[model samples]
Target chain A: MNKILSTVVLMALVVVGCVRQDESVIRIGAAGPMTGDQSKMGIDLRNGVELAVSEWNEKGGVLGKKIQLVPGDDQADPKQAVSIANKFINQKVAAVVGHWNSNCSINASTYYHTANIVAISPASTNPRLTQQGYKTIFRVCGTDDQQGGVAAEFVLKTLKPKRLAIVHDNTTYGKGLADFFKQVIENKVQVVYYDGIQTKDPDYKAVLTLIKEKKPDVYFFGGVYPEAGRLVRQAKEVGMAIPMVTGDGVYDPTFISIAGNAAEGTYVTFGKDPSGLPTSKAFNEKYTAKFGAPGPYSVYAYDAANIILTAMQKTGTTEGTAVAAYITKNSFPGAFGDISFDKNGDVTKAPYVVWKVTDGKFVEMK
Target chain B: MFTQQLINGLALGAVYALIALGYTMVYGILQLINFAHGEVYMLGAYLGIIVLGVLTYWGLTAYSLVLSLLVTVIVSMAFCAAYGAVIERVAYRPLRNAATLTPLISAVGMSIVLQNFVMLAQGKEYKNMPPKLPTEGFNLLGANVSPVQIFILTASILMMVALQLFVAKTRLGKAMRATSQDRVMAGLVGININQVISTTFMIGSSLAAVAGVMVTLYYGVVHFSMGYSAGLKAFTAAVLGGIGSIPGAMLGGFMLGLIENFGASYLSSAYKDAFAFLVLIITLILRPSGLFGQKAMDKV
Candidate 1:
């Protein structure tokens, strides 16, 4: 019994000493909705960072040292994200790669800034995060305006629907995307209506009723799947004669299951076509082999992780300042595409891809 | 749009009524609120999700929704009822002889503990009941209403009617009312107050289970922390309707729902919560017994 207790004590001591304050192991912090509505995003970010670490460690880690990925669940709550940011600072992590929601990333940015910690987000698209001019912040994804511009141009120049109704969740991403779509399409097409919905309330029939009344040829929702699916079904019931469209947040299996046949004609935006892209085929095989499901943000997260590891290798330091400098200075090939952060922490004018939901598969728009 | 808002309100009201019934039943008897009651409601949602996941894993989607919902309801009720009884025995019963504030504080602690337990187990993910409740809308007087709304209303009314009949006719129901009225008198009369209280928990927890499943079916997914927000809303509904009255709780729930829906449509959607509480405050000020509450003031 004495030997067993001593052995247990020794193991605990070794583990504690392993994570010593001055250890070479670089701790990378990632914050996302690990348990809530945007869990897929968090899962994707987790998988991406995990794969990046494994790949980097396999090829000899940055500066001849191992990399440790630290993930914090923010549950997509802005306050929780802020709290996690403070925790990350207290933990003295080298860098952070996280936060899909703009609201979360925005709140977490101030903390990373205060601590001079380098932060890289894979999918927070709100322009304000960049416009805030926080030097510590970086993003792998484009802003709402850029996404809207690409999507709006494609819609007008390609699909050419007669009348389009725009809707949003009235949050940073939702409202930002809706406003950009509105600005881009108002001159080119007959914009029918702009509406905003709440987060928790179950019904969207009123909006659907209004949509049916307006008889818009097309409907675009700047929100996630839970609300979008309801809107789609309610529109069909109320006989809303419109093809539904959405931002990237709506491209999930949940949307198809909820809307069922109503989801057939829906169009959504994507950063890359999962099948057509080289990374998609590779990541698809690996992810299916590993997690059994190819989560929507998996590739983007994989690329974000890849970028951080590549920067760590180039800078020869897991130090935030060094990594950020190397990341901004260098363009690295990623799962989605070649990624290089501009001064404002976003991909320099990347275009968004449009995908149509057909038979529950993301068929790339021709 | 006004009619549409009213219909939406009625559907929401039914949901609030069912949830409030669970709370009011417990409060009516023990005067000790089971804060973990919401967690039980949340557990019911998780039960439904787990059942669906298992069924989906086994390719049981071909099974009718009625059958699936039935399984969900039974499993959720069983789980929550067990949890409710355990919570009462362990948390509330310990503080039975303590001051009134002691039990209330213990209830709050239990609520936090239960919520955190769920958070630890499920993480911080926002889960829904599943499939985002049926999207089919039925027309009501030139206004569109979802089948989910109709489903919630019909099921809740049926539950209320059944509860009323049970409490009026059943021997156990009479014991429950007796105990609720005077625990000492009922105990002297050989009512077995313990059994009455346990039965009260069983009934209330079962109602919460039904509400839990209905909420998930209505929203289409279940999350771990969904109980906290919705539970608070339902508690407000109970208080608004008169905490001790069954029918009043139901009426208050519907009224709160209607007010929230209309407030969202015409006023700010963000302020819908504000409107719900506003209704509660106004009711407290004007008619404290609630819209359907029966006043039986007694002085010892």
Candidate 2:
């Protein structure tokens, strides 16, 4: 009877301690694919969140409380993303900055909406993500319609190929982007070949051989780096010397390294190059010093976290609905430039630009 | 187009054959499907990357590409052989006398363990292999045949031939055959069962390692999860051919590759993987013992 009484007292004390500790810190959630093919990008986004939280803590934090970041790995799967969303809700995170993949963002946003938690995806660009009427859902990146339209315009105006071949990896992001591209170029250009390849299969020679026979003037791939790298390399091996174009998914240093010489002269569409701006200089230096180089979505994730933090500071509360309302009403200056969400929770201005791989680096094409 | 697709199939089949040989050899001896065989192949590719990275760092690749490649392949094969032996001893040896299903489960557990181990050690990103060979090759008939494809085909064939000769001629080979035929009788006849089993794993792992190296070189990329799909296909090949027959494995590998490529070329690329499994299902229904497997009868 004495031992049981003491054990019950100890459990009570531990629970109280946890509740007390949770009260003094504002918890922000960061979630993405931390242990799969897209992990590098996920880690980059997480690091951006960490940097923002640390900077806030050093400056006495928001609402006179220290900031804490809770990281969750969704592995780029929709089902895993829903579970991660539930975990974040259970943890009582004020806001979430993550879910790089479009499908994951779309799936998890419903749970976040029900829990009244704000989710600001830094990389997911599918337009339907914002069109679902979830007031709590937001993103800092350009939507796929804008990005794909820019890529199509560039291909039609600059390359002006007579025949085009479009391929996708059949994921939500890839297929969505490819569909947007196809919509723009549907009647303008003759789509000699269009198909979806299984991602991570690592053998695209057979498919590339089939595409080669079609004799398309240019090729466009709608996928992330892992598949795009191999597809481009295999395309070169199959004697297809035509130029290849893709969207923001292929914007990474890993893609260049994977494709080697085949990466040269390839075209990629992403948000305007902010690294050349003066506002981004300090962030770039600090990020590069800590984690080699910022990935494609690093700055966007940093800006997303900062937006949440600033909104909380301005509202003087960590409540999700209030912070989200503040974000929609105003603009926040960031490393990427002025960021303000429209009524649909997308960035007001979609600044998509064409970048060419030149001499082993992504150089903005005029 | 037909000729070109055939060449692609052949190149792909060569790697599958090399990996299938490992699966078949281990199953022949222990009658336990070594599901971890694919992880061994993945490790071989990583080992190749490490060795090749070192060679390139030392600038030896610039001095002589041939010598550098030879060293990389040999070192990777040697490391994978030792790794295979260790896995067999640790994961399989204790379960040898247990229920058959027990060893198979252990094989799966080992596969997951090795995959996670590599993921934690090397990271989740794909590692880029520095290209040491020229991508240029001559046009064959109507298809473009790269030098790397030729090397993969030639090297795989040479290794298969060498493995056949080793199994047929060596004294150790005869001991392996005896043990596979009847373990108790072979043990009574003074054949070291444990040593023969270890040797079988070593040889099989070395062949898988060779396949790993070839794949990394050909694709110019390597990832930890690569072994899963490759292993599944290779295991399918081993079963399609008689599981215990060496030549049958080679034939199965090439046939599966051709089926996949031609299916992708003619019918649809989306159903390429389905084609290989379709053939496997049909073959199983027609011949339950597999294409080359002999029907066994229990002795009363």
Candidate 3:
């Protein structure tokens, strides 16, 4: 009786595992911060995936099978994200649309690569995410190096500040972006001050005071909105009236609310606003109508999801390795325009644009 | 430039001093590090933000920003005092007679609970205080000193003075000092040990609350995790001054702020936090009892 029970359980386990990858369904995992301070962005990314998957399934499904989205909340933490990636691997997902944070994505990338699972990020913009030579990892957004270079060129050409001060919040994303910005503008401008502040530091006056003495013409901050907002407000309080610039991290509406009037005239660099693109107008309308209003990376999330599904459909198989290769070989029309991954799995020709905060909202500068 | 940096250091140091006093006082009384003290500081900040948010919604913010701030400070202090007292009762009281590590672990557990509670109550996002503090300032030796900085310095000093007087001149303060010196003996001497411990936590929490309000005004933003770094720095300050000495904590906080700002300005700002620890290690090596700590003799 014991031998019969053991053999029956073994057969049941194998059958249950195989049930998930049946030809009737294709599963894609979406991992991001669904419960922490960055939940807003995570929700937007999830909603984007949902919209894309629903639209794809509506168009007679992919290879005569409905696509299923499995969302995992990593809370924007590296360790948690790795566990989420492991869970997706256990479930044998065909592809993953994930990891809103650069650090989180980087942490989970190795796991996905080792498992031969194709992963695409909607918003992890750090260049190192692709530079690590992971064939299975891809992103729909421009890297910090590209965005930082555009920002530096604009600051040098338009603002033409003689003395520049650079500040970073000491995160992988923040420091990487600032370093890239410095590398591009070091020869052209005098970077009189360079400093790193703690992520949640409540005061920047001391650092701002030091920067004030040097009389920098512009201050470049490479950090997210929370710290960036405080830095801008405190810099104003310290009476340093120079123009402050930051990367895409501070492009959130909350930045304006936190910095108040101090955010006005602040220069920011990000991928050109997809909502305003002619190709994305219909998607943006549909997104806003469905989920209130889409976040900064929602369009990119839609593109990432569409890229993965289109690859699966074009390859006519849910095999992860083949689909990942197909993604690189063909260009797909996405909400942001033509999407193709380069050798490093980075989106090809991901353009950056300058934006200025006028009144209260971000207005793209020509 | 040097003078301006010095002024900046002083202002930043004052905020650290405000927080360090709470850690020193709790350690003095119970011999417990009270790791949960950081959560109390976080709660104080959220309280301040909530009170200000409600006032702004009611249109009372435009009535008088200074008066509104005064109200915020009081409400935050009162709420934090109760919270600190309750934390001691629920978490620390049970572990009081247990092994030393027990209460320390309990404090850590309570800190996590309080952090999650606040995160749930007031969303995990950073809350910004409206730009109410006046940005105008006078040049002091070519350094820009804003009114908010002056207010922080003046208010912190005043609170420290009042605290000193309370500890030195009052009967309750004497009971607290007695309990710190000899808890069993003080209990035998008719002093209510529980009441004294509660008062110590209350006072310490109120001071932390004031620091929270000052930081919120100074930074114009508050977040759930702000306490961790601030609390770490303040705890470092307390140790540098003398773990259980009030004056030592104050001096240590100022020294840390000055050292950090000067180091960042002159040396590398990337190693700013490292400089504080380096000074701490060097100072402790020379004087294990801290700059103001009394040498304790092992009883035979």
TM-score, chain A, per candidate? 0.89, 0.94, 0.91
Looking at model 1, give its docking quality level.
Answer: acceptable
Q: Mind giving the per-residue lDDT tens digits that candidate 1 earns over A1-366?
A: 999999999999988866766677777787788866666678777887777677778887777888788889998789999988998887788788888788899999988988888888888888898778887688887788887887788788777888888888877888888898889899878987777777755556545655566667787888887678777765665557578778877877877776766778788887766556775677778777877786777677777777777777777766677777788888888666677778878888566788898986667786
Q: Looking at model 3 chain B, report the run of 10 residues with the lowest lDDT sum.
A: B291-300
Per-residue CA lDDT of candidate 3, range B1-300, in tens? 788788878888988898899999988888888888988888888888788888888877799877888899999999999998999999999889988788888988998888788778887777877666678888887777777788889989999999999999999989989998999999999999999999999999998999888877777777776777888999999989988899999999999999988887787776788889999999888888788987641210
TM-score of each: 0.85, 0.93, 0.90
State the number of backbone clashes in model 2.
0
Given the true complex, what DockQ would model 1 score? 0.27
Which scores higher on lDDT, 2 or 3?
2
TM-score between candidate 3 and the true structure? 0.90
What DockQ, between 0 and 1, does each candidate earn? Answer: 0.27, 0.58, 0.42
Score candidate 2 by DockQ. 0.58
- Using DockQ as the measure, the top candidate is 2
Q: What share of the true interface contacts does each candidate keep?
A: 0.18, 0.54, 0.54
TM-score attained by chain A of model 1: 0.89
Superposed model 1: Cα runs more than 4 Å off: A1-22, A157-163, A187-192, A237-241, A279-287, B42-83, B99-140, B144-151, B168-171, B213-225, B268-270, B285-300
Model 2: per-residue lDDT, tens digit, B1-300? 888999999999999999999998888888888999999999988988888899999999889987888898999999999999999999999999998889999999999999999998998778887566777788889777887898899989999999999889999988988888899899999999999999999999999999998888888788999999999999999888878778978988999889989988888776778999999999878877667876531210
